[model samples]
Every structure is written in C-alpha cells, then in structure tokens.
Target: MPPPQTTGIYPSDSITEVAQSLPLDPLGAGSADLLAGDVEYRLHLIIQEAKKFMVNGKRGTLMPEDVEYAMDALNVEPILIPPRPLPLPQFQALTIPSSSSHPQQIYHLPDDEIDFATYLKQPLPAGVANSSGVKWKAHWLAVEGVQPAIKENPNPTQRGASRPQPSSTSLRPQARTQLPQELQLYFTRLTTALVPPSPTGPETEPERHRLAALTSLRTDVAVAGILVYVVKWLGESIQKCLMAPTGTIGQLVDAVEALVGNEGVFLEPYVHILLPPLMSIILTVPLGPHPSSSSSNQPSPYDLRLHASQVLGKVAEKYGRSYPGLVPRLISTLSKSLNSPPFPSPLGASNPPSGRYEGSLLALSCLGKQAVKSTVWGKAGENISRIDDLAGRLYTDGGGKKRNPLIRALIKCLSVIINPKPVDITPQANLDDVSEAFGPNLANMLNKKLWTASEILRLRREELEGEGEGGGVDGMEVDQA
Candidate 1:
C-alpha cells in the first residue's frame, strides 16, 4: 500500500525564484514544487537530529553548534558557519521586480572591506587576562551565638584575663577563651555599630557613629580590657588613611583625638605606638594627592594637618611634665623639617612642598611661647629667617599664592609670642630691634603690635633678673642700717 504525500510548507514560487539565481535555465512549476517539498523535508530532518544533540548535551534549546553536529551526523553539507556567539554582520535589503508585477525586498548581508596594509601595520589588540579562580577562606561566621575572636570579627570591647587585674599582658593569651559569650556578642555589636556601613561623605549616619564611638571611648570604663587593642587599631587605621581622601583622614584623626581625650584610658603606655602615625600626618609632604586649585569644593590637605597638630598639642601638653623629653623631641622633629633648604638648587629639582614647611611652623607654635622664642631668637632662628627670605622671593616670582600659606603659618607663630597681659616694667623695642633679632624680612612681615609682643617675650627674663638684684641690694642696706 502507498502512503499519502505530505505538502511543502515553504512557497513553491520562492523556490523557483531561488533557482533562477543560479547559472542555469529557469525551473517549471512542477519541478519547483517537487524541489520545495524535498528541501522542506530535509530541513525538518536536520532540525530533528539537532534536537537529539541538544537533548544529549542537557540543554533544552538547540544551539547553532548543535545544528553543525547534526549535519555531520546526517552526512550532509552544512552552510559556512563561524564560531558560535561571534558578532553577526548587518543585513541590507534589495528590491527586485517579480513576475506578479510587484516588487519584493530580499534581505542579504553586506561584506566588510578590510585594508590589509593598515591591518598588518597595526599591533594586535591585547587579550584580557583570565580571572583568578574561585577562592574560599575559612572563618567562623558565628560560634554558639557568639562571634569568634579573630581578625574577621570586630575586636571585643572587654577582653578577659585569668588575673584579677586585666592588663594587656594578661589579655593577649586568653582573649578568645576567657571572654564570656554574652560579653563577646555585645563587643561585636558595639564595634559594628561604631563604623557606618558607608563612609563616603559627611552623611548623618557616619557622623552619628563617629560621635557614638568617640563618646564610648571617652566615657566607657568597661572598655579597659581592650584599651591596648583600640590604640593599636587606631594607629593602624591612621597609617592606612594617610593617603585617603579628606573626610577619611579627618575621621581617623577624630578617633585619635577622642582616644586622647579619654581620661580613663591611661594612654601613656601606648604613646609610643600612637605618636608616630600622628606625626606622619603632620609632617608627611603632600598628604595624599591634592585636588586641583579649581576644585574648591573639597577641603585642602592643610586642614587635616591643622587638626592633627591640635591633637598633637594636647598630647604634648598633657604629657610634657611627666615626659620632659616629649616637647624637645617634637621640637627636634619640626626643626629637621624646617632645616631643609627652601629653594631647589638644581633646575629640574624642586623644593619640598610648602605644605610641609607650613605644618612644621604650626606644630612649633603649638608647643609653647618658649619654644617659639627659641626658634625665633635662638640659634634655630636662622632657619625661620631663611624661610622668610624664601617667602619674599616666592612672592616676587609671580605666584604669591605659593608664599601665602607659609606666611600665614609664621603670622600664627608670631601671634603666639605675646603674653595675655603685658607687664608695665617690660622694655619697649621698635621694629629695628625686631629686624635684627628675627631678620629684616620677617620683621617686615610683622606689625608694630607683634614687634612689641616679640620684644616683651625676648626681654622678660632680663627684666626679672634685674629686679631680683635690685631688691637684694635694698634688703642688704636695710639690715646693715
């Protein structure tokens, strides 16, 4: 028995038109119809085979590569195929008149023209590096409702020790084992709450966290166990944020300030660790990349220096008497920064950034009037005189802006030399004496009032000595009479 024939879903006229495109005679309607049916049957067979490959590959969708594999399996010629997922060419339409007196638009891909000379001359583009493989690091997410004592977790507020008095020495060995689980949880949450999730701008949330952290540092007595850890963390954080943006550096400095202000912490033991980072912020040249002069919206690097200097002043004032060497060491450091030659001698070489010099001056002024008097009128005064000369030259060199910060710093230092209440017996001195004492260049920078102040500060010791001698002479005469 013969089976019924299946009809071709594709149009026979389309098949005839395609045949006309070949270098052969036109096809008759019956031949075109037979060819269309055979072509449609072959297409269906290829698709069915492609689906088998797709099913075997565990993909429900039949990809172009599956079709290629299917053609190979069927022992049939496949069309030219590029790699899968490559970019395809754009299609253009062409209009042609058909036998039905209507124009038909056939879509075809256009060829891309290449210039071999340019292509050969150009360097091959760089291929992307393969990404690092997936990685896993083991850390406890939580242990019995308490966070682990590890770097991955926030440091606990109160570390435990076996001894009655919890010292840093005792806390280190038993930090993990001795902490109560409840205290461990509280420490984790407290530290977590101290840091804002996003510390980008001057947002309210970060400010709140910052204030809260500072308050806790100043007022919380129970945090004594973790005092050592907090100091270490603050030092590390300040070092890390040295090259950070404005708000970031300021944030860490505020933390340090709060720690210094914490009366209960007894920070003298850790001052060695804490002081260097603060000094670095104060003395490091170009504390991170500065924004361009046109970018006035952001705070300049000097503001951070000023704030750090204030904190440094507090540290010195609080500990100066106990550690007499502290003030001298600070002065020595600032002197080194000042002693560097102001001008770059070599043509291509450059002087240190003026910001460093300014910071040194500001820090010196913060020490005390005696420190300022020594730097101005004592042997170290030579450096300030040289800086004054440099400032003058810089002003005449056509960029006065370069000298402005240094001049401001010097002015602030001079302003600090005056006593709050002037003594009537103090000798009066004019600008000539001031010029001879502080150099003519620095003298010109000062006003008459500063000159008087400088003189009072300079002659204060002499006046007191003369008074003591005269009083002794009068007492000796009265006893003899």
Candidate 2:
C-alpha cells in the first residue's frame, strides 16, 4: 500500500534500510520507524539539555564541557574507557635496500620451483608479464581534456563493466523499486558517515559532506527515503554526542531549521517527534557553571534561552495548529518558568529575577499567535483570551522596574496577545492604533525606566556602534525583537 504510516521523524523504510545494513539487525525487520522515533526522542532530550549548556555559558557556541553537563542533566553518563596495559614489546630492525645497483632488476625470490642458483643463472625470460625486471610504462588517465584510451579507461565494451554481477536482493518489492548501484553505494556511505562508531573526534571531510547532503535533503518536499535516513541517523547518535561532550547539536539544529523552513515538506508526520525537544531547549535551565566551580557562580540562562525560544517560536508558528495540544503544553511550560520565585532566600541575594523573561515571552507570543484559532485553542478560543491576563500579571511584579531582557520580551508578548492586527486592515492603517492599543498602562511600563534598566541592550548597542556605522547586533539577543 502506501509506505506505512509514521508519526516519527523518519519513515519506516528509511529505518529498515539502516537496520538491514546492521549485521544482527538489533531493531529487527519491521521496527525501523519505532526505533527511529525512539532515537529521535532521546536526541530531543539531549538537544534540550544542550541549550542549557549554551545558556549557562553566556556564549553562542556550545562547548564540549557544556554537552558533558547536558549529559549529566539527562542522567546519561559518559562511557569511561578503562586503560589497558601495553603489550610487551620487542624491536627488530627493517633494513630496506637504500639503492640497488641493478635498480631495474629489484630483488625477487623465485616463485616457480627451481633451484635459487639455477634461476639466477638463467637469462631473464621474455613473453612473460611476471619478469622481475619489467620496466615501468607511463599511462595518462587524462590528456588534452579527454581520457586517454587505456585498458581500464576505454569505454565499456558491454553495457557495463566486464565482471559478472550478482543478482540483487532488494529492500522492497521488485515491482516497487530498482535503485541504481551508485545510489545504493551512496546510501550506505551516507548512513555510515552520519552515524559513526563513536560521536567523538574532530569533524572530517566525509562528515562535512554528509551534513551538506542533509542540508540539501532538508529543502526537498518529496518523501524521500534519504531524508528519513539522515534524520534517523541524527536521532540515533544524538545521545552519544552529548555523552562525548561534543558541540554537534548546533549543526543538528541548523539541519532541523532547514527541514522546518521547507514549505514543500508536509511536516504532520514528524511534528510530534520534533516539538517536545524544541520545547525542552527553550525551558531547560542553562548549564552555565563549570564542573570545577562552586554552584553559586553559574551565569544567567540568557543566551541559550534566547536561541531556543526563537526556534521554539518558529516551530509553534509552523505546526501548532496541526497538533492542538502543542499550545496547551507550551503555555503550561512558560507559565511555570515565569511564575518561579525571583530568588532563593535565607540570605536572599541571587540573580535579579528568578526567570529569563525573553524565552517565556517568545514562547508565549508565538504559541498565542499560531494557536489563536478556535479549533486549536479549544472552548472556541476562550483559552487564547485568558493569556492576556497572564501576560499582564508580569507587569504587577515588584514595580517591574528591573528592565532585563525578560521584561522586554514579556511586554512585547503582552502587546501582541492583547492587540493582534485586524485581518481586514492594511499595514499603513495600524500606525494610529499602536499607541492607543498599548494604552497608558503599557506606556508607563515602557517609559524612561525601561531605558535605564535596559543597560545590557544599551551597552551592546554602543559596542556595536563603535565597531562600524553599519554594525549589526551580536548574538541571539538581536533575534529577541
């Protein structure tokens, strides 16, 4: 029938191709999609933790140590390698001939049975290809922009190579498919290169090619086996990368965005597998503190949260309506984060706010926008209406005077939720309502104090301005707006 239905990030046949390539088929014959989905789920969790590492460091790059900490957060320990004793060694000198007097007649032992003395005494034989003194002959693979005719370089005398080819055993019905030998070879190499033996070591040329292939595939709308194969390969080894403390998730996220951005691809099959991990990335605490440092020294979850929030918001906008529950879960997650205490306290001194406002604000704004339809919001969109009050409550917190990134995000999200653009009106018609829609309460929130509390933004602005007249803002903070 139709290639079996899959709610996983990869198709069943893609998983089957990978499984069949294995010696023992640990996932068995028909379990490819299930196994693939499970792999993605684990990877999803790893990515969630990876963002924490990014957030904790206050940097854009995901360091190896941060991945290790992400692994720790997931309770996935690294596979410790036990040291093995070196085998007792013995040395022997290899004395190769520096310059043979008879360079053309290099040393050779008699192959055909003859006394060594008699063979040496005999004249060098003619009409035999195996003569030890055979002289070198130069043959160019190509000349004058055209291949020189040689034994191997000549056009095939037959339809293909002269070798007797074995019959093929297909992964699917003969009636259904017949992939070329080159493509089969490519598929094997693609899967192997994507999922290496260990997710450690410097990235090499082959891995780079595999990523390029993945990027190309992500842009395709067709339900190709190769697309599912790459996604499954990524999903399978995600945990290993985290355990190895590798920074590969950055590339992985890029590939994901490519897939999500492809307007041609129908994502209904994959969204369930995709959404939860993205949500985790947005919500997880930044793994900012180093392993050696005292816990109190950890940085704010600023950078990582911002990056994840943008990605999460994008996914919500694209897929929220496809799965109605997505909005509810996103709202719940953001609510928990925003409502968390500002500081832990017998001593009371801690980070200014207990939350990262930017991330919650993003999740709130994007999910609210995408899930506003009556069908997606449930109760004929009553739930979407309630979000305005929740957003407004953030303003009630402690004069809302500390203008961190979070406050900016919260106010912007509130404005959007409270005043979505009217469908009937054009863009030019909206300028007048901007001030009226934001109202006196919002105006007070955005006044001169917002500028003062926005030291991080202002300082960053100055630094970039100093850099050049056409300077761009740095990091994911630029993405907040």
Candidate 3:
C-alpha cells in the first residue's frame, strides 16, 4: 500500500533525500550554534520575502497567508514558516530606521591611513574621469569628520567656500535638528530618477536597468543630505530649466536627465531638496510656442516640444502633487497640442502622422492621469474641469477621428485618471461628468485593465488559500526541485 498522503509527504522522495544529506554536525558544532545559524538564515529569507511583498504594495505583518502564497508562487520551501517567529512583527518596522535616528552612520577614516592623491589616481572605468561618484565620495569623507582636512586648511575662507563646512558644535541636539532637510533633498533626486519613463524612444532593457540603479543610488544620497543648501540648489536648478527659452530648454532637460541617470549614487542624497523645486518648475512652466520664435526655419520647435512633453511626463509621475500651479499649465499645453496642425505620419498612410502636437497631447493626458488623486488637484478644484474639457476635445466630434494611436493613448490616460481605483477614488464631480461623456465603453476598459501590485498579491493569496483548504488537490501545485 502507498504511504498515507495525509502525512503531508509527497510521492517524490527527492526533497526528503536533500534534507537528510544536509550536514548534521560536519563542523562538530553543538545544537546551539546550529540553531543560531539556522535562525540567521531564516531571518535573511524572511527579509527577502518581505521585500518582494513590499514591492507589491503589501503593507504590515507577514501573515501565514502571505507566506504560503509566496512559497507556492516562488516554488520553494520557506526556511521558517510564518508564525514560527515568536516575536513576528511587521517587516517594514524592522527594516526601516526610525526618523529620530540616522539611517546610516558616517565613518571617517583618518587622512594618514589613506592617501587621497593615490586613491584618485587608481584605475577607473573609461570615460569616468569626471564621474560624479568620485567627487561625491570625496565630499562625503571630507564632511563626515569633525576635524576633516578641508576644515583644518590654512585658508579658512577658501576651505569653507570649496566644501560644506561642519557644525561648530558637536551637540547631538543641534545635529538632529539639521539632519531632516539634508535627507529630504537626497530622496527627491533619487525618486525622480527611479520613476520609469513613458515609452518615448527605443531604449534597450539593459539601458533601462542601468538607469534605474543610478537613480536609486542618487535618491539615497539626496535623502541623507536633507539640508538648506541642497534644497536651495535644487530649487535654483529647476527655476533655470523653467525659465530657459524654447531654443535652450531641450538641452537643459537633456542635461538634467543625463545627470540624474548617470550619477544616481552621487545624487541620491539630495533628492528631497531637488524634487520639490524641480516639480515646481515643471508645473509652472508656460505652455505653447516660445515667447519669441528665434526664426521660422529653426527645426520647427519639434525638439523643444518633444523634450517638454517628456520632462512633464516624468515630473507628473514623480512629483504631481507638490506644485498645484503646474496642473493648469499642463492642461493648457495638451489643449493646444490637440488643436495643432497635422504632420506626416511615421508609419506611412496606414496611420496618421504623430507630430510633436500629438506627442504633447499624449504627454498631457499621461500627466492628468498621474495627478488624478494628487492633493494639489483636489485643492485646486478647477483643474479637473480643465482636464475634462481636454478629454472631451480629444474624443468628441469637434476633435479629430477617434481610431488613431494618439486617440487610444489619450483614452487610456483618461481611463486611468477617471478610475485610479484602490489607490484613489475618482472625485465625484469629475467622475459623473467623465463617466457620462465616455460612457460604459471607457469605464469598462479602465476597470478591466487596471492592476496594481497590491491587487495582484490579493488575487494570488486568495488562490493559494483556496488550494490549501482543499487538500492541495483543487489548484495547480508546484514544489522546488
């Protein structure tokens, strides 16, 4: 007769065999040491799983249900099951440092221990001589200690101007008061870079991955630097970008994007300071043709139009709520784009030409979708009406035909804004009007297509729980080999 299936044993003995083969006491260590090692390994695994859950927007404790689903989906036996940890608490609480304390402590190595000149001369990646990483690290070290070389320089005025001067007092109370601003700046830049760009051009997967990593690092540093200087610097940079003429805007936007992408680690610490001001500029920049056209023959303002669209799209994704003033400008821009003249289509006569106007229209639609639930929009109240007008203009009779890709993209954006779902409820005034205008077709599409990480996890958990209750026979099953 076959072994009782109720033993919770599988027909395959492979798992049991591997378990038996693991070192019982190969190092001659006692059970205490072995148990400690096992606990550590289990903790690491738990942390990893928690990270995945957090990425999927699952907040709070790792319930048995979450663990079971994670194990089944990942096709692995978790080292320790949920509820096994006697003091099992929310993973986020453990992983994230408290606001009262520093997330990371700066370690200052004595100047004599490492020669800065020699360190700078070491072999580096090609084309990295001017890399921001090198400069940022040097700056960090110089500022970390009380008696840093920069501080002890003979010319006090020159030294102070070249680098961030340390606080005169070593009082813990004073340091604590000053840290939050510095940290905010660092996080702002990091978040901006981390936000995935909308599909605008042909970029390979590897390039995308590289950009994400760079942004993540920059955000970390920016978060750390949350100081007045960082905030001011960020604000000034954004102002310059906003004030730039159409002829120069494209180059400026490109420079900001490139810097954020390449030196993410170096910039991470300044994100908080940089983000708010950058967002302000993006929101407030005047839309439409340049104040004064340089010449009728100058590249038709296509490059500026494209760059502006791309920058606004990025800003909307990252900092939509911080600058209420920008929403009207965004709606105005899209309205103009939809009304602009047609250009030659990219995909031949089969599709309508997607000119700078179309691109801007699509970008504006994306921005509105992002801002649907933003606090700024809620406060402004009138912006939603403007968004509705833009939406109506794009899809209604006075607007062009509805079958184009540009139209489809606009519809998708409106759907997202009108029904952001679990993340945010559509405002009643906008919802009633938008729903009536778009009717059941657009509403159904939005409801069917929208899927956030939290929603996905909920579905997976439900499926797994259903299987567990049915003796594992009712659902598809997988086990680690």
**Candidate maximizing lDDT:** 1
For model 3, how does the per-residue alpha-carbon lDDT over 18-69 read when each residue is reduced to its tens digit?
Answer: 5458965333224334444555666566657655655555566655655654
lDDT-wise, the better of 2 and 3 is 2
How far is 225's C-alpha from truth in model 3 (Å)? 14
Error of 1 at 323 (Å): 2.3
Misplaced by over 4 Å in model 1 are 1-203, 290-298, 342-351, 379-383, 393-403, 421-481
Candidate 2 residue-wise lDDT, 298-393, digit = tens: 223444455556666778777777777776787776766655544321111243333344566566666655432322233322332233333344
Better of 1 and 2 by TM-score: 1
Ordered list by TM-score, greatest first: 1, 2, 3
Among all windows of ten consecutive residues in candidate 3, which has the lowest summed lDDT?
162-171
- What lDDT score is found at residue 39 in candidate 2? 79
Ranking by lDDT: 1, 2, 3
Query: How high is the lDDT of residue 257 in model 3?
Result: 52
**The CA-based lDDT of model 2 is what?**
0.48
- Model 1, residue 113: C-alpha shift (Å): 67
